[model samples]
Target: MREPSMPVRENAAEQLEERQSDRAYSKPVVVLDLLWDLAFVAAATAVLLSSRDEDPSMPLRLWIVGYALQCLLHMVCVCVEYRRRHNQVQGEVMEDGSGSGSGSGRSSSSSS
Candidate 1:
């Protein structure tokens, strides 16, 4: 069987880079998503609590506060992780492009 041609490989690489670039999220948008998620979770919890017989409102209120803090922490951690990985991938792509450009512009593969 013959290996795929260079034009095909370059097309595939371009598609991959486009996909990678598209996957990045704006920080504010991500935070807004997290807030929406928290709203749904909180609404569910409120519904469940309303159906119960317990009367102590203070503890539940405190727990909700703590849960919100935990969610904020989770959002921070998630954003940090995403940014780190995105930067790493972009850096790798830059290094790869530069490295290849510095040599004979031709790729090392025999398909050229």
Candidate 2:
């Protein structure tokens, strides 16, 4: 006779198998995202440099502040994107059903 928890176990196993089969991210997608981030960084740097020679008036100060903010925003965006891509790659690897044993199984079992 099956235990009451058996169906729950089977359902959980099926859900895990489904998650494992999902394809979350691709290498080309990550590469393109990185390239796009690089472009934003380059553009931010250009704006900062171009404003360097401006007169020290209020408008110039504002422009400098704006450029600095842009640079900071771009850096934050790059960091977020990189983290997102890394997470996606990890998810994809887990889902591939390759049984690569990348430590997730151990972690999940430990949590349970």
Question: Highest TM-score among the candidates is held by which one?
Answer: 1
Provide the lDDT at 15 for model 1.
Answer: 62
lDDT by residue (16-100, candidate 2, tens digit) is 7645533223445555655666676667677668877876546655654576567567656756766775675567577756858
Candidate 1 residue pairs in clash (backbone atoms < 3 Å): none
- Give candidate 2 misplaced runs (Cα > 4 Å): 1-58, 97-112
Could you list the CA RMSD of all candidates, in the order they appear?
A: 8.0, 7.4
The stretch of ten residues in a row with the least summed lDDT in candidate 2 is 18-27
C-alpha lDDT values of all predictions? 0.62, 0.61
* Residue 28 alpha-carbon offset, candidate 1, angstroms: 14
Using Cα atoms with residue i matched to residue i, what is each candidate's TM-score against the true structure?
Answer: 0.44, 0.38
Which candidate achieves the best lDDT against the true structure? 1
lDDT of residue 53 for candidate 2: 82
Model 1 agreement with the true structure over 3-98: per-residue lDDT tens digits:
568778886786676555446455566667778767856875775577567667566656665676677677777778768756755665676785
lDDT of candidate 1?
Answer: 0.62
Could you tell me the TM-score of candidate 1? Answer: 0.44
